[model samples]
Target: MIISAPSASEVRMSVNKSLSSRIAFIVSLLIVSVAWSGAWAAGWSPAAPMLGPRSLHSATRLANGNVLVAGGFYITTVWNFPTAAEQYNPSTNTWTSAGTLLRGRRAHTATLLQDGRVLVTGGESTTSTLAQAELYNPATNSWTEVAPMISPRAFHTAVRLQNGKVLVAGGAPVNSATNAAELYDPATNTWTAVPSMSSARKQHSAALLGDGRVLVAGGYSATTPFWSSAEVYNPATNSWSSVGSMSTARVLFPLVVLPSGKVLAVGGNSGAGLPPSVDAFDPATNTWAPVAPMGIGRYVHTATVLANGQVLAAGAYGRDSAELYAPATNTWTSAGVMSSTRGEHTATLLANGKVLVTGGSGGSGHLATADLYSPDVGSDLGSALGSGLVQADTCAATNDSTPACSAGSTAPDRSFTWTAPSSGTFTVSTTGSSFDTVLSLFDANTGAALGCNDDVSASTFQSSVAVTLTAGRQLRIVVDGYRTRCGTLTLNIQ
Candidate 1:
């Protein structure tokens, strides 16, 4: 997608940057895809694909636990902007048409209002930048035109304030960037002009801080050098103030608030190219500090705050690789590679804690494919199995007989709590053990047997059991030895 600028000169410069980036992306698409093809890690599984292909779209999770995805650009012989919208039901794992937008556009912003409605603001239509705005009511699954923005804008940032108003700031009207800011009050369905930002920028990132202030940072601008500067908006005074600048200037990135109330600016284009650098903003100190870089440089991607407080950054210009950031440790870990190499996609954290990644452009062109990522829960269990463990013959005294070991050993056992990563048949094996082993799986809450195994064959003492599990299901795994024998053993779950 092209970055919107306010002036003709800025527009030309922005287009040139976009074109060069696209050319480089297209040239490296195949190489990147091939490199990530077999690198898929655990916790990621294919979800139902979207009805149509799209990129630079919006995805919002509704209060009812469903997700609404709307308006984006696709490609055929030429760029095709679609007005179509759809809803995804996490309960049923299905997608249904929500409706169509009054105006088809891309590079827009959607904010979830407090009243349970979604506000969609200005974006670039097929022919021109648009000032039009609309709202989606989940109650009726319908769309209605609302008051338009103060000016035509694209690649802007919209943040829902604590008082139930949305603050939209820093976007390009047609070709040049604008510092103009506005507020949309859902209670009255009106737009009010707010104080402009200190810098004219587009493709920027904005997030609401814990203290009821909005933070805007790192965007593309024609008037500024580097564009690394940041500013904060105080709703109480209706004023904007400059804050500490990031070490790296960036655009087309994501800014997310951590559980600790710190804001993190992820990887983005830095004029020269995409940078892996990330920055964390301390609201109390009003300072920016450099954090750990990502495994790969990326832009036009999505960074989602997970239920566990970790951030999941997925996709890139043409990369399918995904990674996770742990604020507690200030480190990054590979989440996994997606099923497709995509960029400009949207990632929404569902109510169930699984992240749903939607359509985006890929090496093959616009993609309809989607993926679901299940974060590793009960990681301690995995860590325990990484090394050998000595089984205690303590279960016999407690009369634990739910697994029903054929040898009838009240052998000492170890039990661990594990949440199923996804719904499917998984093999639970005790293949590396010093003695005959018995493995059992049970519902964590109900204490009911789901599966048990005493041995895979008469020729082996190790046991293996395959059990079907539902995604997010909590269960207990009991590792015990057959008869009175107990020794060091290792467990594997796949």
Candidate 2:
């Protein structure tokens, strides 16, 4: 048997770009297999994978509502780091190249800045523990190295401040815990030293409080056991002060700020073994209280607060089980299990209220599999869409030819609400549709006709129409066949 992996550069390129977007699409999607119909998919079924298999990477959601996954190593016989990066679109359920990083890194921090760019900080590459820093501009889709940090550090935590700066602190794994802390200002593109923590913390957790303070808590020091000590950083004063201590010392746990503003630190290695116990810190009271324990001990897991205000704890070292924490009861219940065991992976919340879980070390090693967890999906396709897939069989048959299609166009149609991200002139097409098609645009709320077309650029039947859109414009897109026939069709806009 023959085997080969796409190089890092092969997979990272911009998608939906102007001028030959198809070429960019082909080049960028050499590894990822993004398709059109994941809405029909069920629980934990595979969505598209990334450009390649990776672990210990970071996933940050961009302002455009796309996910930026950057820099993780391949587990092909040896741990190999890659500088490549990719973006995932929840709307299309596709993966495309965001762009490569300036430095190859793993175990790093990627934080989204206020200016719609991303700040990537220190982590290990093939060469060494890196102090290198870079910024990712989504508008231009490129990376530029910024000023390196004052110290070479990895395994640190970075939280975007309320003041539009980023606070980076702690180090671990490859390096000993350091109380060193610094701030990165996007305005000046520089890093400045800040008051360090009272004690060293590595692989710790950080959360922004409602009052604009940042709470840093629990992680291994450079030596000995992990610490239960916690502290808060006040941006106004540019200082750190010791706060209430946790009941247990842990490493690699999740610190999630609930809707009520209390921070919940859950499930981690408590010096000896993984513990399911959780701790809650109330900034209002300045105290730490013990909460309920999980069904199983888990470390290196991911926790995300859902729209419904429930916290989902997923994937631990060698475990596929998941649990949900309820704030009202302060308890954990079995949520379910993933299709496979995953640790060191990422889970992102999409606008549609579904959770997207991506690459990590799974039971088979570095995972290329990704899946969606949505409360809406069911086993049957018709029941899933609530509209029987809403596809037209023929282009000219769905409507009476109103200067668009021929007189016979009628039957088989689909209605969709498209939310515009930006104000622009967009060309919507059913170019490669399976049959002759007619397209129409309508106001989603009023059902008033906005635009209609039967053919594009003197083509036979495929439809294309240009529409001017404003940000947050809600549009209703309808497509139908031109004759007494029905078939599948793919839609695109650029």
Candidate 3:
């Protein structure tokens, strides 16, 4: 729900309230001086398992809010490929048969198309890498074979571009990796060759930047066993360019786009073993910086962006433990243990804010078990104010503003949490900002609107909001732009 920010007049009146009530405000603060824990009691819980045990599978959340799990290997005396697919209904927490694939495959990529259908791309079959692709129509609950890619690949990365075309990049065709890339146009149901990546990589990671460019980073190939190099694919120019390389070479990891538009590369294997290190990429500056590493070293694990903007990295090779990464604090917190150990799993964020983790290899073998994760929204909001940047235009999708103050902000925003030190009037301002700023406040616990301000006066582009808050009361302050203006800003709370 969108909450309107208070006007300048309202803010002025609040700050100028009679001093006669100062004693009462102090008393209220003392009465509630206890600190708030803001801990999340809900963590991981078992969900309905898949119809059968499998690993190296693909799980895609459909438009209908159901997860579709397709083709993977079921271990027995030998590796057995499963052609049957299943759909998970979050409403009922049950799994139902979706359909069957034209061929049994694993290590493939399943992409959700703009038309609400899922496109399953090339992967390894029982014998060799398969270039054949197929589309699953949720409305009809069936699969239809589409045009094959220009190259056969397994463990490749397929990212849906902003223009509705799917970009399929490097993967191993047989025993060696290839630099080949292609694009799938859903409108014409055809595949076209695109410029290949500078590096031949498989089991690498790729994410779409806010500016519509795809960033592909670190993987292994026959020539180069490990790669720390990174590059970007620009569809407008139909070209590839090198960007900053990661400090550590990684493979089989995941690149997640944060709310701030920065791409985060989670833990992955560095040839030696799993590395706990993590890195964040800034597209605006084309640089990579080290961030807080996870407590557990993991590779082939799944990192999912929670609804509250925190990242949850769960399971690894023979590990069932999970942890949460808070972008606001640059810290990691334990997310609790899962029911079973897994790697090569798929974690998909549900529409209702819960995360669904599906099949992967377990301690015994391939697993059919599934788990759900509920995030701690309150904990992610209580970070201390500091210097920040407004990156991606995520406010529109989140409806974080209203007509009162931030009606049409195409610019990005950053959020912080501040707790009242004592009872009385306090001022929250963006005095040393680089651009025109819009500041708004919300109750951290309940997410209720508190106050907001666009500017302090006619001559100033900075914003300030003054309100009386009780001691230990945490508030979420958002630093947004006037419209499309965004840059570096410092948040001051006094």
Candidate 4:
């Protein structure tokens, strides 16, 4: 069932049923206020670097579970762009060079087609922006050129639509920018002009939302020097509408469509250089708000959403550092550093639950070294109480010396008693809007973490945290370190 939007009653019901356990958790307030202190404060180790080292490139996933990385400048030349291509096999954790492009290029866009091929569009060679387009067939491992675009352009926005057509929008044709837009039909291998944007832009970012609309935000405008203005494109109506402007004016930024159906605009350069700014836009309200900021300023970077609903914003033209964003808390955390400092590289999420980052300019020049980011199983929530569990007066009348559960302590947590469902192979679970907390199942006879292990790769925020418990017996439930004081959590058994 497609739910375009749900009413307020639906939202409240979800909150109540979902957070029943958390509401029962009685603790203090110290833990809730200190939750955000962990943002980018910790760094995870990267999996491994890819084979080659080429920067200013693009990478796309194939239907067959492999990734295609192609074209970028190499070495430190005035612009020694290479047409070389490579394919990565996630199953084997290896990379094999594939067919190269007919022409060397950089800063191009690659759109994955429905028929299992990828359409490579315009980019700059050593001299000028390209109008040409090409197609790559994974079956034969080759590239074939199609008809050129009506206008020569590079750094333009290209999107694959529901009808199997690709829409190419505004960018520079010469040294100057243009508002022109075009459509490409793979069925005919031809290009046709669509409605031009209200403003001309380049180095902007575009994202397709769940409701079949594309939100285009931030880039340089020909009229203004640079822009923070944003707009939405309705492919069904073939029209554009001004949405909202960003908190800061930036170009060469990255846009990610979150699981919640909201759009997040990450770091970018402020015309003269890069800036450390992160903002989110809600299409439902047509507004933007500041979220967490990145640790470092970045432009020409890549922001990729993982299967687990976390976003990995990695690689930028100037820096090698990367960060992960958790929508559950609207915060950013450092996810470890890359093998090399890269800018203009491509980060592609593989089907095997790993992200493949390939090719970009590593300070020295264009590079080909690739890296993979694998998410950890997550750790236990420990003994810390998370933010936002209903803190009722556990000792309203009798206990006045200590902070009551209702008033909450600087750090508060919820305690609950559970009768084990059965004896064999039982586990605890939760459904709430908090952290990825650690769940521990204890013997009613014993009050220790499961197996006496403190780190269980799961952290509780608002949802239920469960560990396997001995069946037929009683167990204790405790949630540590919630994401927010305002967030809710529910505990249960499964």
- Per-model TM-score, in order, reads 0.73, 0.71, 0.70, 0.67
Instruction: Compose the digit string of candidate 1's lDDT tens values, residues 367-455.
Output: 88889886764333431221112222333334355357555566677676776777887777765454556888888889888888876
Q: Please give me the total number of clashing residue pairs in predicted model 3.
A: 0
**Cα lDDT tens digits for candidate 4, 1-494:** 11123234423643432343223321212353333221111233333355556666778899988888877677643557777787887655567877879888777889999999999988888888899999999989999999888887777888888788888888775557888889899999999988888788888888887887778888786678788989887888988889979989988888998889988889898876667888999989989998888888888889998776889998776678888889898778888888878878888876645677776777766665666676642332222222211222111122112111112222234455555545455445433323323334555566554522212222222333345444555665554332212223334344
Alpha carbon lDDT of each predicted model:
0.80, 0.75, 0.82, 0.67
Please list the residue runs of candidate 4 whose C-alpha ends up more than 4 Å from where it truly belongs after superposition: 1-52, 379-494
The worst-scoring run of ten residues by lDDT in candidate 2 lies at 379-388
At residue 311, what lDDT does model 3 achieve?
96
Better of 2 and 4 by lDDT: 2
Per-residue error for 472 in candidate 4, Å, reads: 24
Q: Model 3 over residues 301-362: C-alpha lDDT tens digits?
A: 99999877899999988999999999999999999999999998899998656789999998
Which ten contiguous residues of candidate 1 have the minimum total lDDT? Answer: 383-392
Which ranges of candidate 1 are over 4 A from the true structure? 1-42, 379-494
